[model samples]
Each structure stands twice: as structure tokens, then as C-alpha cells.
Target: MQTKSFAALAIVALGQFIAGASANSGYAGSCTNIQIYPPDGNTNYWKIAADCKNNAGQTNLNTKINIDSCFSNSNGALVAQLNGSFHSSCTNIILTGTVLSASCRNTGGANVNTSIDTNNVIGNADGALYCFNQGNL
Candidate 1:
């Protein structure tokens, strides 16, 4: 009887250990820190965040994103493309600053696409956002 009780307790303990390990098993993402500034003329500030997603369980990511800057007067547009690998399930994104309007969209892909709009699209000297991997709750 004692041996059986000990075996059951051991099994329960092992199950708990396994559950804890799996809780945080598949978490991987790449979040690069970025600082944004207000544009010229406009006093408002703007910032952006990215939450890259991992592709499959293969542990590989091929991402290409564009960041565009459009002047208020329809003065053409400037676009910047990004390329990188994101090896995580999901990433948390946060942005803070003053702007006319800001937003983001997933578009259509494993990677996430974001956008921000300011009245003048001004860049601030000291304004930015933070992005990183989210912890399991």
C-alpha cells in the first residue's frame, strides 16, 4: 500500500512539472526597439509597434514590411521596406506619443503591418514605442 501511494504522488508531481514546462514551451518572436520623432513643422509626435508572428513550427520567418511617410500636401510619399526573421508565436506591440491619428493592420501574412498618421506627420525628437514577446498568462 505504501509503495502504491508513493507511486501516485510521484506521478502527480511529474504531471505538474510537465504542465509547467509546456506553459511556456512555444514562445518566439523578434521585437526590435524603435524610437520615433515628430515631423518638421508639425508639433505632434508619432510612434509605431510591430508584433511579428512565427511561421509554422519550422522556426523560420521571411518578412517584408513597408513604412510610408506622406506629407500633408500630397507631396508624394516616402516608403521604407523592412526585412527580418520572426521566430515566435506572437509579439506584443505598444506605441505612445502625440499625433493626429495612428493605426495598424495585419494586411495578409504571417508578419504584422502597422501605420501611423499625424496632422503634419511631424517627427518628435523624443517619442517612441516598445515591442516584445508576450508572456503566457
Candidate 2:
């Protein structure tokens, strides 16, 4: 009887150990940071910068920049979206958006294609950048 009891306790302890190991197996989610630069210089263009980190166990990580609108004049419009993907940690990511024309009537635009200027690192997860217009028309 004592041997049987000892065996049962050992099994329970083993089960608990396995459960704890699985709980702390891998990185659970992702982290993303974004910075926006206003329209400037001769080109009158805006830019969005992003940084992302993907913990282990994550997959199909995607990063994006979403432009709401650019309203100044007839030539004003916004780039719809800019995006990038990663499988791990990264830094100093540069994503360029469309140029804002110096026209009043050409205002408002949506997600535009993005160019990945620099991808310092790679990991697994999803991330994005959102640009919303909050200026008066």
C-alpha cells in the first residue's frame, strides 16, 4: 500500500511539472512602436517610423502604416497605408508614405503602398501604424 501511494504522488508531481513547463514555453505576443514625421523639405512628404518585437512562438507578424488623409489644397491627398512584416525583433524601421501636394482641392486619400527602408531584425508576429487626419479642412 505504501509503495502504491508513493507512486501516485510521483505521478501527480510529474504532471504538475509538465504543466508548468508548457505554460512558460514561448513568447506570447508582439510589441510595436510608431513615430510620424510631418510633411517637410522640398518634396512636401510625410513619413512613418515603426519598431517591432515578436516573442518566440509567434508567426506571420505584419506591420503597417495607415494614412487617413492629407488636406491642404486641390493637390492634397493621403497615402492609404504602409506595411511591413517580421518574424522577430527589429529597430529603426522606415516606412515612407505618399507626398502631399500643395493644392487645396486635392485633399483626402487612403492606404498607400509601403517601402521597407530598413529591417534591422526579424521575428514572428503582427504590427501596424495608423495615421489619422485631425486637421480642419
Candidate 3:
């Protein structure tokens, strides 16, 4: 009986360790107050508005960042222009039947390996966007 309990405890500890190692590790920042406005430039383009901030993890020191993106349902992610000193990593923005999924990023250089459910953005309630400095790391 003692052996069985020890084995079970060891198994639980190993599981926790594996889960922690495989967890989603991000940079020292996050994107908040994300609001998508309808069509800023063309009628088929949706504008991006959010409050983002990140430490110098993957990109430069971004106290506050503004990420402007032209995302639409018909045209997908058209353009991502940011008003900061970082690279726009918003690629493959696909609007799969109202479920928009893109590698939305605003970083100088960073690498992140997380699952699809890790959330890119926050405050949207329904879904999450992985935006570290409007991006992720």
C-alpha cells in the first residue's frame, strides 16, 4: 500500500513537471483593450486598435505601442503597419468563418512555441489574441 501511494505521488509530480515545461512562455508584456473598428481605409478592411506594452524581451523597449492592421473578413489580413520601433509579425491572418486566426505579432525579433489555445490577445472575452507587444514571444 505504501509503495502504491509513493508511485502515485511520483506520477503526479512528473505530470506537473511536464506540464510546467510545456507551458506557454511569453515575454514581459501583453496587449489589452483590443478593439477592432470596421473599415478605416477601404470598406473591406477592418482597423485594429489596442493598448499594448512590452519589455525589451523580443523587441526594443516598448512602453506603449500602436499596431495598425487592415484585417477583413473578405480580404483577410491585408496590411499591418505599426507606429513604433518594432517589426510587424502579423502573418497568415485567416478569417475562417468568423473565427480569425493569425500569427499577429509586433516584435523586433522573438520566438514563441505555444499551442493554439494559449491566447494571443486578452480582454476580448470570447477569444484571446497572442499579442506580446501587439505580438508574442
Candidate 4:
């Protein structure tokens, strides 16, 4: 009887352990909120994403950084001409330094505005001139 009780207890403990493990599963999606810097009268492009977790035995700093582009513009006006789309479920994205060549028309800049689920400005959002600043990375 004692042995049977021990076996039953072990099974219950194992079930709880598995459930806890499953509850901690992290999210998955393309990284977002990446900013890059470029020299004057020049263009630069790059792609960045991250997969991080806050626990031991779990992989931390799974960031992938790569140079995705370069451009030729000086007045900083050409810096906001980049065209790309990335989706993610993670929070805490950082865009440090200056951004590179990126530009977006009213409709083209929709990705940036929609990424945060806001209708701030994208040409006709409240009749404001939408500015897509991709250089302030």
C-alpha cells in the first residue's frame, strides 16, 4: 500500500512539473523597433530581431543583427525612405542612434503606424502631414 501511494504521488508531481513548464513558453514573431544610424549624404540598411527570456537555462540575448542596406542622401530627407515590414509579439524594442535611408508615403508609412495599433498619422489621420522619420535610429 505504501509503494502504491508513493507511485501515485510521483505521477501527480510529474504532471504538475510538465504543466508549469508549458505555461512558461515564450512568444514568437519577427523582431521590431530597430533603429540604425548612417553617415551624411549616405545610406545604410540593416535588419535586427531578438529572442530573449528572463530565466536560467533559457536562452537569453538571441538577437540577430545584420547590415541590410546603404543609401546616398545628405539632407536627412532621404533617410526616411526605407521600405519593410516586421511583426512581433515581444515588447521593449529599442531604436537607438540615427536611422538610415528610409522614406514612406502616406500609404506606405502605414506599417509603422499600425505596428503599435494606433491611428496617429499616415497622410489623412486627422489631416496632419504624416512624417516617417526612419533616420533617428
Q: Cα lDDT of all candidates, in order?
A: 0.28, 0.31, 0.34, 0.29
Prediction 4 global C-alpha lDDT: 0.29
For every model shown, the clashing-pair count is: 10, 27, 7, 19
Instruction: Give the candidate number with the greatest lDDT.
Output: 3
TM-score between candidate 3 and the true structure: 0.24
Q: Where is model 1 more than 4 Å wrong at Cα? A: 29-137
Give one digit per residue, the lDDT tens place, for model 1 in 1-137.
99999999999999985564343222222322222333236422222332324433232222211112221111111112111111111133223432222222232324343333321222211121111212110
C-alpha lDDT of residue 92 in model 3: 49
Off by more than 4 A, model 2: 28-137
User: Which 10-residue span in candidate 3 carries the lowest summed lDDT?
Assistant: 117-126
Better of 1 and 2 by lDDT: 2
Put down candidate 4 lDDT per residue, 1-137, tens digits, no spaces.
99999999999999986564333222221222323322234433333333333334243343432222212122212221223222121112233322222332333333221122111111111111122322112
Q: Write the per-residue lDDT of candidate 3 for residues 1-137, one digit (tens) a residue.
A: 99999999999999985554333222123544434443335443433343444343232222221223212122222232223211134444433322335544424343322112222222121122233224321
Per-residue lDDT, model 3, residue 67, is 26
Candidate 1, lDDT over the whole model: 0.28
Off by over 4 Å in 4: 29-137
lDDT of 2 by residue, 1-137 (tens): 99999999999999986564333222112433434554446423444344544344333233432222311121232122222112111222233332222211222452222232222121212333222211111
- Which of candidates 1 and 4 is the stronger one according to lDDT? 4
